[model samples]
Target chain A: MSQGSTRKTLASIAHGRSGDKGNHANVAILGYSQDAFDWLIGFLSKEKVEDYFKPLGVTQVERYLAPNVRGLNFVLKDVLAGGSSASLRSDSQGKTLAAALLLMPLPPDCPARLFFKG
Target chain B: MDKVRIGNACGFWGDDPQAPAHLATGGNLDFLTLEYLAELTMSILAHQKAKNPQAGYAGDFITVLQSLILSLKAQPRLKMVTNAGGMNPLACAKKAKEVLDQAGIVRRIGYLTGDDLLDRLPDFIRQGIALENLDDGRPLEPFLSRVVSANAYLGSEGIVQLLEQGAEIVITGRVADACLTVGPAAWHFQTPLEDWNTLAGFSVAGHLIECGAQVTGGNFTRWQEVPRYESVGYPIAEISSDGSFLLTKPQGTGGLVNFETVAEQLLYEVGDPSAYLTPDVSADFTSVEIQDIGSDRVQVGKAKGRPKPPLLKVSLAYRDGFMASGTLVAGGGKAREKAECCGQIIREKLRQANALPQEFLVEILGAGDSLPGIYQRNDPPEAVLRLAARDPSKGIIERFTREFAPLVTSGPQGITGYTSGRPQVREVFRYWPTTIPRDLVPFQLGFL
Candidate 1:
């Protein structure tokens, strides 16, 4: 549908638990260590959170910014568990998903702290 | 004879993807060249060797080869030459063949190597050849133990040899960029190796196409006026057997080709322009000609040459240990003042921890040191503070990282930009370049 809906869908797929209400599963809270939070959300920020997750089926990712602490909530669609089945990950020439990812500039500014507490 | 038209697609591994296809079809070219090696890239590849022995060399070349495979198959007359082989041409060739085999193309591919000097360093040093730094002129002894890789920039002759050997595709490692285009022209024209003028002209042609679309319009200062930027075109070198060539690009592709575009590409790799030295000859880039051929086409040719300098250039990468940088901003009218105070505070904290390097640097961007005389502002409201240092000593850099947060409260203008904790130390790989006689170094060519 819209960009927002896609992000929410992708987030669900990445951290969702089994047996969700619909195709969108619950976004799992993958632990909340300050270090882990900083790294995960910080990686998102460093890599341009919205752009990075957009292709991964994360259409609408709501990120809450704070001083040294923040959180990003997204809706993920059918963007996980397929591995070799992702279209955005590979564009027809066997170039790895990592290679495609490298071409996109990381957000010029990285989050100072963990944007995601959970 | 028909003019030898050589077009280029990707300048380096990270270069734009659509370049080769656009230039090949657009320029109506006979040959295509892709140049993809820089001094810094060589160092990065050397660093990769520490983890994976076969990891050195740019793999993007293979990707580009794959991208153009279908196009080449459709156009049998289109021969491609590239130095994407990096430090390992034979290995690169085999990988390329793997891709070709998948495409059902059983063409004879030629690979040229011998650019690296891994086995001959000790002998060269023993022969009294002090491979001094071209920039600082320091002898390369201190870095002997940490030296990881060393390669000389070969010229067009080696590539010419491969082309003459009936190679449908020629791959090389660390050859001068200009040599990529020059070699094919020299081979096709059968230009005598000693014909300095023609060689220099071909050298100029090579230099023009060396950066791919840079000569066409990518990154040109006049980029604003370039048409259709969504699909920017790459450069094409139309060469004649007599040493004259034109610099241009595909029709209808985004990017401009003019004297200014050619001039900017010429400005790259600064040396005395009158005597831009290479292994084959010292080129006189000053005598070159650039004329607009048509829409998206510029004719460039008529260059001069001199004898090659006696010493060959070498690139050496050694383990210089690790480094890391952390930054914070202190705002307000006292921005400059606050930045200074932060530096002092970091020094104090690191010193008390007994973790300061023997030599370290603390810089204040927007401060006089960062811009030096570039920006003339009347006491800017904010300043970006930076600190850098290195040491042969252990834990010094990590110790320096721990000192930043204290400055958040201690510094004059408070703090900003520090979201993550103190930074980590990263090992630094340094570069060294030296020269040796062409006769001294030897190479072996075999399939992997």
Candidate 2:
């Protein structure tokens, strides 16, 4: 699929998973290809993810890179309210967080050619 | 079997009951590992033990073992390692022996002890071991009375010892879930304790398949890509002496095993890829690599690690309060609005009666209640309204559970789906993660 003039979601270039570790939830966004991985290193940032999930009242967001798998793990701090045992939310664990983040619109800065081609 | 073939039958306590038999027959595995202990499972087991002395360990183990006795007899060399011993390994092992003896399959059922630290907390505290909460840094003084379960996560040493002593089935108390594989891999290859790299590799393999079908596409992001998600195959890690491994499911089984599945599980819920701290070793996930070598087989290697951490992680659960949750589905137009109003009506009624819970949440599940503020939808054809509340007193929570029934008749027009009766008030045990020095607790392997 070509990266068109119309903006695409991050799901266009990458896939991910999110799970909880106590009150913190880590989301690993893996690039579908090497080109997408290179583009994501610059396009997706800790600041960007934090701002996106700010409404969830997370305290902090930290990013760790695993180049072997072309993954960027973003740990959202204090995001799960009280976490699994104590959380009152339907998702006591933040299991759907990755799906929520996947909806984010890809910024225009991401050029059309840099998009992943499967 | 130079490369030990280990298959995990079940991940958590309530996982598939038939998987043990399926794996025992179809996997052709040298060892069948069952992981049952979760962070808060020990607390639940503690309460069960308090009621009945022989009720602490996982009951599913006996039932699953009973069903798999013939399969185990056919494959006599096949061994098993499980933390299903929960709060009581002796009782679990005793039950296992009874089942095996009855089936005429006599084997030395080995169970490890000395991991349960509930009784030792005061002694350690008197000796100045604070046993502080790792997350909040709070000391244990205030919550001592409320503490229900306290267990140190033992490493692979106990299981390795049991295996070395010719035990076919090894049961243990709250060892790190990954140690189910680590112990067998270390014993099979005689891997040194100080050999961090190899241990790390074993730990990586263990963690990948630790959650049973997770590595075989249970939680894969691309759900459609997995051929059969419902009846998906359980994972089998064929680990070599060098700690490298290949991950595959039983042949003709439904599921996919590729680099994505391996990579996803490798970092699932792990904070830092470079430092995944388990009791055996702090595995460096970044150094690991996965390659799909055709036919549903994925080879993983190059996992590095540092020496085992001096302090072992501890999970202590203390009774915080009582909590109850109930759900009701509403249909037709404007269901979301009616559900919201009904929840507010219930809370207002509770407030008027002076029994309102301290922590209350009303979630319109279908209308994006899972992610709350992150994802919001306008309205759906029907939505389930969930009411969850927590309070220090049980009587207060008892009052909250009664309100859900009245809403079905008096509140909204299409309020239904309450056939399960009033929600039971459950004692809430908040997780306290901390660490203790490795030398403080010693491991002992005993035969049943």
Candidate 3:
């Protein structure tokens, strides 16, 4: 909430994909560079992601780090109603979950200058 | 570096049919892998087999083979591996043999069976294998009557055996998708079964290319950077003996094979980067390194592996229910409001008729409600209203399908885009992921 600070979405600094594991969905968010990855590690906490996808009725959320690829994978449990054959949702397999998560607003005080167009 | 090239052309059953011939002709490779089965594909094949004795395999593969007959004849050294034998490997192999004969190309065709455990369910139960669902830990007894297909994901051992026996084409049923690549890599390098590190590396390579064009720019996050999607080249892994490989695509073809593209694919459907479970080895994807070496080329190496699990994951699908989805595009000023109103009308009508389904969902496509939480838009010009439902009774789903058509005339004025007719009702094959003792399900290898 600082003046003169720019606000940006996570999609501007990262890219990701999501897939289903039964009723659970895993979203892998990858940063464009090592610096962006470090920034993500410090900012994108489990509670933050849980709150972001709270509307989907996610029972639990666990984060895993892959430093080699500068990526963080968050598994959202019970997000899919019943998965493949059972789910009635338009994005049943959570294919659009990653894109939706990428729309998360970054903190105003974050290093916006470090980000580059991907 | 003693290396062998393996290219995966067909990712799933409905991938481009011309991909196999294109890869076989252009990619100077040792093996061409085609993965036809998805998680629920076996249930469909099982349903087909129950209807006809001679059915239940990926018939599209045979058609692809027919188209690739000239390429098969031209590239005699190029071998093929596939799990196109959805529920029936023998039948698929027989059809493939006939196709080969018609082209006068004499090549040994081998197949791996014993993955299908539907017939052996009673035996497994007698042996005290509970086959509980991996997700919910629910007992399999309640769903036994409706079980359609149950197949354990086999490893590369059978595929290696077939290749060692001079089988030019090896077909299998329900082998791990990665085994299609690992089998050839292990056979070519003569790696031991317990060589976990090398096997793990091969597993990672296999996983990358298992989805065919996925590793080579298809479904990439950075879609704009990808060169050509119309003629996207399938992925080819040039793997070395020491568990290293270069992920690349055929030259002069569309699509990219950069560091970002390969990295994105490495995490596709992946659970833990440290423990990517496969039948061969638990590949540690985090240890692997990827670097963009050149145009459409990525150097990927340092993939470590752990010991194979004592049990093999089984993909069991049973008849759960019937589902139907219908979509209607709403336009004009109050599109979002009209779409929600339309959904409520249908729900109320269904409630009044006592035909309410087990689960009903009304989604507004343009309202950013697809993911539900993040991107809610205000007052969209138009929106596609998608109404979907599932029920145990087929009659209920059939009834639900008819409700969409009536909405065109009876519903809100803004409602449109209903020319596609009533939504077709489809039988739901719910997936049941479980594990079986490795010894209980043995790989059966045979030649046609």
CA error at residue B190 for candidate 3, angstroms: 0.8
lDDT of 3: 0.89
Candidate 2 lDDT over A1-118, as tens digits, reads: 1333366888888888888887789999998888888889998999999988887779899999999988999999989878887888877778888878877888777777756565
Q: How do the residues B196-253 of candidate 2 rate in per-residue lDDT, one tens digit apiece? A: 9999999999999999998888878887789976678999999998899999999988
- What does candidate 1's lDDT look like per residue over B296-316, in tens digits? 666766778887666666656
DockQ of each: 0.01, 0.54, 0.58
Rank order (by DockQ, best first):
3, 2, 1
Deviation from native of the Cα of residue B153 in model 1, angstroms: 1.5
Inter-residue clash pairs, candidate 3: none
Candidate 2 chain B lowest-lDDT run of ten: B369-378
TM-score of candidate 2 on Cα atoms, chains taken together:
0.97
In model 1, what lDDT does residue B374 have? 21
